[model samples]
Target: MKSLSLLNKLKDYLKPIREIIYGLTLHEMDLETKKARGNLDQLFMLVVFGDLVGLPLLPPYYSMRLLPYIIPSLERWKRSVLRERDLTDFVSTDL
Candidate 1:
């Protein structure tokens, strides 16, 4: 069962990416395991593309491939983290 879940597949798919993400992000992340697991997309965008929603130069095909599996989290992640306008958003909510 674990083998089929997209999250687990993503772990295997992007193992190298994990290393890159952890190295580039703020050390304050304190990435033991679960935190890193939860924030994979954030780390990818931060470390590789430096964008939030979409990358201007990167092709959409890659994202398209991973999109289905991460859909549930993506929706919430976009709403809570990516959709917010600016720094003013921080103190406005529980985020």
Candidate 2:
């Protein structure tokens, strides 16, 4: 019982310290990774379904075949592709 109590206290004491270390060391890297992944997902969507938005990179038959798998994210992909961007959008991600 004493050992368990001490271990719980140690964990509670270290929790904030561990989070602080992660915030300082890993948070930015995690954000960058997520950003890169989202960009790649959008790019993949563009290649597979660009015809929907008028770019026509793939044949309609192929896009149609993949349509069911892609349906859930289609609206989000379209919005991201069609939205306006500016220099600030690029600048914010770098910092």
Scanning candidate 1 in windows of ten residues, the lowest lDDT window is 45-54
Q: Which parts of model 2 have CA positions greater than 4 angstroms off?
A: 53-56, 59-65, 93-95
Per-residue CA lDDT of model 1 for 1-95, tens digit only, reads 76579787787869888777877784445544656665676665443342234554445666556556656665565565656476774443322
| Model 2 agreement with the true structure over 1-80: per-residue lDDT tens digits | 99999999999989899999999999999998999999999888878776767888888888889888898998888899
Best by TM-score: 2
Q: Stretches of candidate 1 above 4 Å error?
A: 1-31, 45-54, 79-95
TM-score, candidate number 1? 0.33
| CA lDDT for candidate 2 | 0.87
Q: What local lDDT does model 2 show for residue 88? A: 86
Q: Please give the lDDT score at residue 70 for candidate 1.
A: 59
What pairs collide in candidate 1? Answer: none
Q: Predict model 1's lDDT versus the native.
A: 0.57
